[model samples]
Target: MSRHLRLALVQAPAESFEQFADGLRLRMKSPNRAELVVYPELHLCSRGAEAMTLEEYYDTYAEPLDGPRGAALGALARELGVWLIPGTVLERAEDGKVHNTAVVYGPDGELVAHYRKIFTWRPYEPLCVGREFVVFDLPGTARIGLSVCYDAWYPEVTRHLAWMGAELVVNLVQTSTSGRAQEIPVNTANAIVNQIWVASVNGASPTAQGRSLLVDPEGHVQVAAVGTEDTTLLAVVDLDRVAAARKHGTGGDSWPWDHFAPDDTPLELPLYGGRIDPVTWRPAVSPWTPEALRPAVPAPVPTAPCPAAGAAGEETAR
Candidate 1:
């Protein structure tokens, strides 16, 4: 079987949830429909809230996963009979903190998976950081990973997702700044390094700089949405390509994932002050496991003073 999934990336313009929902209903009325549809970050949030304080706006919409808005989104997906990723919504956690979280709804209106933004564009973004990496199965088609706007900028996030066996990493973005120019390259870079498919979807004009792109496992941009215009990019991605890329080597050259042998010397990482045993390494631990939930960054380890050195070390210490 061709494990190809047809997708529609909705690069809609600045609009409220109601407007987007209505448009989605109309779009699904057509015969040509994508099996899965994705929107940009914060697509359903009230753009009118832009006038309000960020805190006010986030608090106003923040709700749990089973909130009315979430149920409505799930119903929309079921009614349309398509897998839907309606960008992200502000999730009100049990601890009363608000998080920018991405959600997926299946064709059955079932909530598939939710991943809170890990790297929340810190120093500017007030949302709390999420600790775990999330990947979900698309049943027979593929296993997918979720990340928000700023998460793609960190290679560790995507690398971990790939380690968790994600064939496609969906990076939903909403950048209204010039920094988007750099995101494009990083999107491709992530795909190249991981040998996985990447769909970096950004919003359209007035709200974002829409230079969304879909990259193949070999880092080739298959469909790049031009300009900051409201548009829909349709493509059929074969999950098999990801397997083929990893198996045959990326562009038939490097095979990073399988390069190390069991008997090979463990490569030492000075920053971590240890080497990962190639035979015993397990990078993708289940996020839900209590023992697996280590601090996002490990605590600093105390080390003994360096051995007495020559003039160079003396100068460094001074």
Candidate 2:
């Protein structure tokens, strides 16, 4: 099977729900239409939240997974015959807790997967954190994983996803322009170290610079949006690069999977255990069981031989 996937990244301001839908419609109509369309984090609620209080934003924008916004996104995916990741929505789950949720719709417009933001950006954002990492199969294509905004800062998030057999990892971001220089490099490094494709989409607001980008397994930036402009970046990602990268290490050394232990038994470090006062340093109980730590199935091995050095290059469609 061909391991190529054409993807479209939508980088635009979420001024209103209507504007978001319109922008998405326009992008989908492009001559370089893609099999997958991705949007920025908090794409539907961020702009509106700027004008209202936190409580008001929650009351106004937070809805269930089956609400109007999710329905509209599903309809759009069905209409375009594209797999869609419509960014992270502010969801009020049945548990009555509000979460920053990312939803995936299959080409047939069915909800296939959803992931809540595990590491919420702190200080002001009020959202319930997610416990588990999500990686799902994309039928005949490749397994994909999702992270949102600050989650990319934690290497464990991407590493766990890769360990779980994700060839491509998507990150939806909503952050200030000042942080772009820092954010891009870190995410690019995540791609290189994890040996997976990293597609990051950022919201286009005055506060947020829309430098959406795609980084290949080799850590090369395939495509990036210009400045804070509203634009769509389209690229053809070769999933085969992932296996090649894992087999051949970055910097001329063989990739060192033999020494790495992802499932090492838990051990308490003395510095953490002995330094901090037990009363003040209470750790939250983890929700993941031993079964959850293991991959549902082993990652599919690539049958093809590695490409010649420097043969893998960015395939961008403006």
Q: Give the poorly placed runs of model 1, Cα more than 4 Å off.
A: 272-275, 280-318
Residue-pair clashes per candidate: 0, 0
Taking the tens digit of each residue's C-alpha lDDT, what string does model 1 give over 6-110?
988888775667888898887777653788899998887758766879878876788998989999999999998999999998899999888889999999999
lDDT minimum window of 10 residues, candidate 1: 286-295
| lDDT values, one for every candidate | 0.83, 0.78
What TM-score, to 2 decimals, does candidate 1 have? Answer: 0.86
- Which residue pairs clash within candidate 1? none
**C-alpha lDDT of candidate 2 relative to the true structure:** 0.78
- Weakest ten-residue segment in model 2 by summed lDDT: 280-289
How close is every model to the real structure, measured as TM-score?
0.86, 0.80
